[model samples]
Target: MRRDKIAVLVPEMEGKIRILLFWLVVMSAPAFSQQAPKIVSSADTASIRIGEQIRWTVAVEVDSAAQVIFPEGQTFSPLETVEAFMTDTTRKNDRLLLQKTYALTQFDSGGYILPTQRIEIDGKGFFTDSILVMVATVPVDTVNQKMYDIKPMMEVQASRWGWLKWVALGLLAVLLAGGAYYWFFLRKKPLSEEEAEALLPPYERAMKELKRLEQSRYLIQDEFKQYYTELTSIVRGYLEEEVHISALESTTGQLLEKIELLRDAGKLDLEDNTLRQFQNILETADLVKFAKSKPELRKAEEDRNKVEEIVQKTKEAIPEPTEEELLQQEEYRMAVAEQQRKRKIRFALGAAAGLLVVALVSAIGYFGFQTVKDYLIGNPSKNLLEGEWVSSSYGYPPVILETPEVLYRKEIELPPEAMGTIQDLDAFAYDDHRANLSIAAVSTVFTKTDEAPDYEGAVDQILAGFERNGARNIITKQEEFTTVSGIPGTKVFGRGNFKIPDSDEFLKGKYAILLFGGNGFMQQVVISWEEDDLYAEEIVDRILNTIEVKTVI
Candidate 1:
């Protein structure tokens, strides 16, 4: 009996031991969780259309002192990584929670597995849970919506304004240049010393001349004939201007007789002694000039002094002029000043004209006439080609391109029946009708998943859109094209006739279109310009070369 009881108790005791072990493990669970880091993975959405974005995030909680590492580079397989956002951190109770996010996308339509992401904390690797994502195709309704292939570029005639603009610009430039020249070079200048001296009254000018003669070396060099000639002319000029007599042309006897007449008539009130001195000096000058007689230097000096004395006495004896005479003199001086001012104005205008002509000729010689004309008048195509270019990405899948200017967002209105077919669409454009160049970029996202996009049909609709905007007689040439990033698409180029607004006439123009479609997403670029525009042609080619479409397969 005792042996059987002990056996029963032994089995029961084993059961009790198992129960104790279970309790111990339950109590230690919190301690284990606290010792190890916690990692979690999540996504903003489980299903996204192709070319749409998926915000994938991985979060880890570890000790504050621990170092954490996240996956880098193109580590996410089956999906293209658009961007990697910076890690976010949060602190709680001596622990740090780090969260890192990535922008992921796929170009092809299918289901994908977001594999477990590896994370590291304090030199140990950890992993987050795997995730499942669905990439759906954007659909198109070919049966209801009309579609067309790409159209060729058109030929556009040059506008009269093209040349007219250049003419206006040239005139403006000439005017500006002429004004600048006049301000800097042709404006009135201060009077020079000789000019100022000539404007002085006769008595002051004569005295200045005498002082200047005294400073000369003519007497020292023994140039007596030249000296006597200049000496007599100075006094004669003084007498002619101050006394109103013709002293310069008269001989010594004629001059003396005139002075006597004046003195007798009371026109000049001169003393007899002063008259004698003046007569003597005039005779001496005639002898030196006509007979080649050389007088002693001392005699010449005395004669100069005596002449000066005679001039002073004559001036003192002369009566003051009447008010009428003074008024007449003042009017004469004003008239002379007005004539000089007019003369300066004429000279400035002539010089300005000459400068303009020279500048125009030089510009024409250096650059071709057409090129210069276009620059001045402003060629829209040329300016667009040479101006600063911008490289940017647009649309869902992102069409990367370069353009002369930033494109503005264009609002697209869809018909009521088509609204159900298209989920979203974005457009950007730059249109210059005067320059005959129009460019646009468009991207579409479809709603239905039953059918793939009809690329050719869409191209047809785009060509028709051109007609609605004034295109006519389109001739298109379609071919396959590939972007820099190896994204293949359709290219159409041809010429067409475009109607001029408010006129019956149509202009020859050129156009090019590139169409790229996959699954439910479609992107397009259209360019049109006047034919024979080399600058526009170059712009189109460069823009085409820089195109790139981001895709994931």
Candidate 2:
């Protein structure tokens, strides 16, 4: 029994000793790393000719997972940098290599001490060794060369500014003569009787034109064509001169448009029926003159009487100008005349100033706008701007949009996460996502949130998901953007390979624009179209301008 028990205890003791040895070996073992972090600094040549460039390089070796912050804005005072290349990054397995190169030059010939550069990696700081550089002037072959003494300085006759002085005197003399002429002749002239007559009131001017047209004897000679022409001209001229419209040049349709515009602008108070009567008269006159249509004598007379009625009604509708308004108008005319006289007096100066202004504008239009546009960049789809656009609303929160054409509602299957938070989603799309010369979309969703949505994060996720579906080579740049209605959101824009619909052909020249805003409701606007489509960009802007974010509590 003792032997069996001792044998069992011995086996157990041996097993325990083996376990202890394994533990000791494991604890004492050295750890292994795939890459060791290091930094290197060197120059292509330690010595350089004065004003010549020295290729200076700094390289860092770090682990792929490590964060390395290289020195920035490092100044070499005596030796200036001509060009500093951006930091280049490369990876080899688990290690990452970062290299920065600079071209340094020194004008003064001397030895200068290069400053030590600092690098930070994973919260640990490392430094580069300071080095000395020699910048020396080029050697001359004096032993075999002949040196000459400096030549004596020759006296140059100073350029004469006498011509400039004469020009100034001439300009002054002309200005004085012009001033005297204006003072004695133009400014001193009083208004003549005919000139005063031309300044009659609006109603008075209309009456004069009507009376003159009547005296032309165009009505009785059966120059009915001439009669109606003169009558229409008198009426149009009266409207142009009195009502401040370009009625004489306007067609019958154009007259109505202009009148409507004035009515909307609160500048004119003409009734619809009055405008309809005016249109009818103009149309009848056009028929008589151009269409060779002979109207009955009574109908012609009736049309003439209708024109007279319109004139009377217009005169009655003319509100008596307030005393202050009449005075201002008179003063404005006099001031304009005075300015014209002054301009004649200072014609030379004004011409010079005007030329300078024109030159400045030309330069800005050609140069300054280009430079500012480089810095003040906006969405690239600015080419498609046009006069016609259609506005419509879509989705739960009603995403209002103004696009080149009305957007057709598109159905999309929502992801599970979105379905949970979103109660309803409505999408509107303009194109089929293929050959989208200019495609646009607007979406609004009713979500279960009273607080403002995470627009930035929401856009990120949206872009991420968008990249996965049909979209390849996706690149996105995000910025804080605001809606036209003052709703804060995110602006995501970039170029990517847009997949065409129902085909395998992928186009690389396309821009993707996305805007997102939310509160209790979420709104999204997306526009992806062919690259360099200025018309599409203009449409995108129009659609964006109509974006309105609504919160439904």
Candidate 3:
């Protein structure tokens, strides 16, 4: 019985030993294979002249198939390895092969040691031995040499073409001849005063008719339609004579359009309001004529009065002839001489007054703005707490903060509850080359104490009490860690679609918010929105990241 028990225990013991031995072998296999790889470099000592190419090869062999990583900052010396090829094998017939070839050339004569490359196989790393390479000096020959220095070849200067000079002179001669011919043959004949007076009849007749209509009493007699018709015809006839357009034949709207074009081109001196008044009178007349509508007696009288007033006003405000036209007219020479004398006096007085006013304004504005900026910077706490701080981004407008109580009172003023909710509130400052204001929050009557355990504990909570009730497509991207107003914070950029209540489609737009804070007070939070999603969040991130409290005083 004892022998039988012993035999059974022995077999069990042997089985346990074999299992342990198998595990030991498995663990040692990795350790043994992790040994450093073997590396050998050719050319222990070699000589080469300057500007001569030298070829070298490094061969490495490892125990098993393993990945090799080169050493950091290791390179071939005086020799650039142009090509490197590596080979590996796992079969009993063949082994792993790593061959590296380097082609080197040196400009300076010096001996150099080619440092060994670092090889890494199966997490084990080793360095190969360094090889020496000698660079020889260039040979000098002193025989068959001349002692005197040779003169350098001179560059020839290009000569100017005489034919081009003659051609230019010929062109000038031809131009002079043509100008002489024009002066002698094509000169305009002087016109007699009689001929000039004859040319004035059309303008004179139009002016006379306008003056007669102005003095007439048709409007006072309640004939508004006829009065306006004759009045418009008189002015139109004058325009036809003065500006060469058939204004009388055109509709009121068409005539107004033509007048506007002429005004823009600087051919007319009629004020916009005056032209608009004419259009109103014509439109009213058309309504009475085409729509068969009757006008009030008082309005008819006013229309008639306006017609005569417009004709006289337009006649008095006729534009003077342009400089080119003045040169063509005999009367303009006298007008120009008189204008030059008046212009000199006006220019001197105007320039002196303008400079004085500009200097005073510039000094006042500069000092005033500087004082205000200094005050704000000196009292950041007061400035920040006095008003509810509000900011906006591109595609948005100014968001005003009414009071501090609104923010610290724990009330959230969402879009629906707020009066005149804002969208695309973009505030830009020229100095920073970036949007100064982005991210906005409004307070409502909803308080954190309404649902939380306590106010202080509620503040400690992350993303609690605050509701994203109306925010759409909200995406948040974590930016670099930073501080605002000396408060440690992390930047998070959020962008999404937004819509405000009781507004047009312009109020529905994209918005970006930058939330920065850790535990205590948040130094600054910027918000921006745009009508279009134009990388507003990216711009917000850039602004928030660059926001360093220049002065916390």
Candidate 4:
């Protein structure tokens, strides 16, 4: 019984293994067979006249279903689209057919090639061929119309004014008379010269007396209290005359405190020590004056001398200058004149220098602009890869070109293990003009599987590297253009040779080709530094034949 059971279990286990292997093979088959959609242009005819409508059809064929996106802002005038038709029913058998019709018209006469169209099929994209359209002018009628004369338009007249104006004028005259009388009666008369002179005598006398008191040497004779008192009175008298304040009646302590209050209010400019010295002298004098205390004779004499000095110093320290001093201000006038002269000179020099710089910059800018314009118009470079070619091995995601320029840079996504070993790759295009192309891989690799990473940084890094390598001038011919692939691609080319930095062996011979792609979903191709002798003609032919434009919208 045990041997029979074992024989039956072996067959069951073998059957299960076979089923698992079959499923794996079926899943991997689709990955290998997947290809980018085929985009092609099918127009009834190539040429159409201006002001005449032309219908151009674009056909996209794919193995599976697809979404075809038309270009934005499509207009025909000189070519106008009368109608557009998009139909999916054209799909027959296993292939899918996607088509869009556009009626284009141009009012002016000229020839223009329509930009490439982008198509997406089964999540893959491709570009269709560019179509050229011709435009012609419309004829005008020769017949003229006869002219006729007509009558002129009439104008309207205005009416004159009359007499209540005089009555109103009379009332105005009476009101003016009353206003004058009231203003004259209310206004005060100005003081006469005699009265003004009488009022000034007391101020003049008080100042003279204060000066006489300041000259007295009472404080130098051991009379500290007397000296401080006299000094304070003189300062008070001067303030009273100059500022109309009754400072003379205030005590020394009271006066000093009031000055400090004024200083805090931004009304005084005296240093703290000036006020403190006044206060110290007054306080010492007060003790001598009121308490009958006699300080030492020598000290009292010094104090007395300081009192005279203080009185004179305080009078000189007042903020406002006397009228006579103002009249003698010739030095200040001379200094201001000197400053104005210097300022004018500086202004004139600065203006001249600025004008010179502006003129120089204008000349340089005009010449630079002319150089760029000439290069773009007269010496345009042709696309190195413009025709048809086939790939021996199809990569996972097909390489796409975004622009027509020569230098191509693209970022390719890959598994961590595969990304680690692939540092960079190169592509080349061989042409008679020494046109070359090259792209480098500078993407980062990650091992973690939890979340997907942004590949934009990796793409940007690769583009930056291309620019730093001076790829812009490698193809010197102006015909070189920038182009994008159905995926993401950047192409730039011109003319001239690019010396690979720090290399003893220069790629000086002829055309260069650089194409890179990965099994992982992203890839790039660039061609640069072509050899002049070896395979130059063949390389150029191969590149032009295989290149295709894929448009997204």
Q: What is the Cα root-mean-square deviation between model 2 and the actual structure?
A: 35.1
What lDDT tens digits, residue by residue, belong to model 3 across residues 1-553? 9999999999999999999999999989978756556677675337776445566666677654567664432177545443343443333333455665555554456778777766676677676777777777544221221222222334544334435666886898678656554554466658896676555655576566666766778757766667667766766777777776768789877888888888788777788789878888888888876776678867866776776667667666668778877676666667886786577557655665786578657766878854444343543223333333223221111112221222221233335642332221223221111222233332112222122112122222222212233435443333334344343333434344543434332233333333222111122343444544234344444445444321110
lDDT tens readout by residue for model 2, 1-553: 9999998899899999999999987876644544567899999988986546788898999888898887655376666666678889999887889998887776567799888877888998988888799987543211221323323444545445546656886898688767766665567567896787688876676677666665666656767777778778878887898778999888888987987887777667667788788888888889878886666767766766677778778766666788998999999999999997677658756665786578667767878865445323632333224334565556655566666666787778987867777777677766633236555454545455554554445555655765765777655444456667565555666677866767888776445455554445556776777765545655666666776544342
Could you estimate the TM-score for every candidate?
0.53, 0.32, 0.28, 0.23
Please list the C-alpha lDDT of all candidates, in the order they appear: 0.80, 0.68, 0.51, 0.50
**C-alpha lDDT of residue 106 in model 4:** 47
Worst 10 residues of 4 by lDDT: 473-482
Superposition-based RMSD of candidate 4 using all C-alpha atoms, in angstroms: 28.9
Q: At residue 76, give the lDDT of candidate 4.
A: 35
Select the stronger candidate by lDDT from 1 and 2. Answer: 1
Against the hidden true structure, what lDDT does model 3 obtain?
Answer: 0.51
Give me the displacement of residue 460 in model 4, in angstroms.
Answer: 45
Error of 4 at 129 (Å): 6.3
lDDT of 3 at 414: 38
